[model samples]
Target chain A: MTRVVLVPGALALLPEYASQVDPVAELRAAALAAVRWLGPEAAVLGDTQGERVAAALMGAAGVRRGGTAAYLVVGNGSAKRSEKAPGHLDERSFGFDAALGDALVAGDLSGVDWSLADELWASVDGLRRASPLVSGSAAVDYADDPYGVQYWVMRWGS
Target chain B: MTLRLGRHEFDDDRTLMMAIVNRTPDSFYDKGATWAEDKAFDRVAQVVDEGAEMVDIGGIKAAPGEEIDEVEEKRRVVDFVARIRAAYPSLVISVDTWRASVGDAVCEAGADVLNDAWGGADPALVDVAAKHDVALICTHTGGAVPRTRPYRVEYDDVVRSAIDDTVAYAERALAAGVARESLVIDPAHDFGKNTFHSLEITRRLGEMVATGWPVLVSLSNKDFVGESLDLPVGERLTGTLAATAVCALAGARIYRVHEVVETRQVVDMVNTIVGRRLPARAIRGLQ
Candidate 1:
């Protein structure tokens, strides 16, 4: 399955799109929802636009400082129609996530170099074998096109 | 019979919207639709339903440097045109080709117009178009016919060069027995132009209108837009709409575009501006 690793602090809270513009609040909500899908052991952390937050989030997401796995650096950016947190991400970090939606969902960890990006993507074939984030039924279909993948993580039953 | 291509009307107000159906296997967009009879026919119906007055079917990719083998080109053209002909018997079909052999097959298969990029440099194509009694849109981009002198940005005469090339193409069509009115002329906007020259010609499109026949202005998503707006092809829609508005204001009878809905709106708005000078009408009526 494709591996999608998201580092916190990559997200922004922009008021321009305020169905509700509160990032911390939305992250809390997302955390609550993800636990339903990923189980209670799944830790939820938000990525602020700061570097320290990025490093901590990347570490928490299991992205070693210098490894390659498909990374979906989710932060404040609009899909153009909805509220997205705003913070500048270098183009590759932003673009790769947007291009390959499937890879971000599958969490494919191989072929990715995490050090090259504050955020990036790779296929972690082993993670699928070990992690409950993807179930046996889900593992078969997790790897997706690796072009541009930015995903909101939900580890399999927590 | 009076004919209309799209929004620009002739005798019958039914403007023929000639949807450009490129069946090139490597077309920039919609490449997979080529040679697949079902997909190609579906595209034909889609464009026609989208209010295309006619469908311009082609086998070769128009983007620079891509060439199709003459035999395969002819076969694809014939097969697609014949199918469209059989399906929409009353539809006005224009064959997009500079190649004489392919042009011959489609024309013989009941294509109504010959839209040539080279302006009849191929004498045989002109003869084919003439024999088929089809209307011809003679177009010239600067590159299609090499300039003995490198194209100068400083034109001692912009209108003369545009009209001269168009007139020459019209003369060739006339010599081939195409009716004078049936020949439409376009100022091949980006085909051989620097920005200033292109803008200059566009600003003075009336000079082309002065040539007496109808004018077809095709500034759709061309280099001029990309260079000016610094936008890729997909993002050139707004720029395309602006150029179409300018072309319509300058009296271009037909506008070739990828974004049909917006192009139609811009032209209709321009037509409204031309049809009734609203401010003047409003002032006089109020007075």
Candidate 2:
């Protein structure tokens, strides 16, 4: 049996980028709670920046790196969810994120369009790589893109 | 170092706003605007509403005029200090005077800080502060007598003189049984110096901050700002806040200002730019 948790690669979650009034307080709390369920030791899978965010969250949540069974994956959906999003408004974002979010909750991401995810500025590298490890219905902890970017915090079984 | 201003304490990284509330009728700025006790009370209320962490209540105007004796000074600020203390328990009430007699009177009335604006003219003020266990603002006036204007004062190095004099006064206050955290230093801009001296002090304020004592800058609508911009009293606020930004960059801890909102904004903005303060609520790009 393996445990897996997924969090957004939001740079604001990093300690060094913190603001006096945290903009991502709820998201960070959800991500941290999800990461903690990955157990004492977990393997991180993400792109360069995503990995840095994962490391910071692990450090904050007291999660260590050793065993590979407990996987902490960092990724997110479209950045063009709205006009103010990082990638600006893209009508394709809603459909793309909907498919991706469904795939994540259903625990099957093999049919995701990597090219469309890249066009929408979605970070799916870790999610794509961790496809084989995720199974069964995921326990969705958080799902929203308040900043025009899509973010989800979900955990797969032990 | 943590700052203990009477019953209140602040972390070292926190900056403070000490709004000016004049009880004198002839003060250089806002002449007679808040001279009436009720009017002064209103001023205190206004600053508190505007988020002033402290209020520097001055009885006698800084400039020379008809002699305001110790009794008159006490009559002006003591009851007012008690009134403010009763109203805003958390507010740091600073009584600005160089007379230890009036200092003692106000301290008994619940004043928190003894702002010796004349740069320790009455040496016993520290003793009074010590007895009350309150904070004292040790200022540098180049040994100028209380309520006397600077007469063509010249310093080989104005910043050096300010640092040396203010630090010595702080040391004296520390030795007089005042808590080390309760002693603050001020460069006393335009108090006993010409525009040039004041400018030098403003430019090199970091040296004063380097003394490890919290620095209180009273730059609001002073002569130095007027001379720097050739602006009149009402127009000098811009120049004052500009100088305030410079001092904030150099890490001044307390700002004595007539305009609390504007000064607080300028200090917060400058400190954020200097990386000493985090953005109030930043989500510009990392969202």
What overall lDDT goes with each candidate model? 0.56, 0.92
Stretches of candidate 2 above 4 Å error?
Answer: none
> A1-158, model 1: which lDDT tens digit per residue?
33333322322322212222233444434432332332112222233332343344444434344322222232321121112212222455545444333443444434333343333322222332333333322222122221122324333221
- The digit string of per-residue lDDT tens for model 1 on B1-287 reads 34333112366222234566777676555555645767778878877777766777777666654456789888778877878888887777887787777777887787877887655556677777677777788785653542222255455666677788778887887898876657788787765667667777788888787777678777777767877899976688888788877877777776665556677777767766675222211211000
Off by over 4 Å in 1: A1-158, B1-9, B12-16, B29-35, B143-156, B276-287
Worst 10 residues of 2 chain B by lDDT: B278-287
Q: Assess candidate 2 and give its lDDT.
A: 0.92
lDDT of 2 by residue, B1-287 (tens): 78999899999989999999999999988989999989989988999999999999998888889998888888889899999999999999998988988988998999999999989899898999999999999999999988889998899899999999999999999899999999999999988899999999999999998888899998999988888789999999889999999999999999999999999999999999989899888777897
Give the interface RMSD values of the models in order.
24.0, 0.8
Q: Is model 1 an incorrect, acceptable, medium or high docking prediction? A: incorrect
**Predicted structure 1: lDDT:** 0.56
What TM-score does chain B alone reach in each candidate, compared with the true chain B?
0.84, 0.98
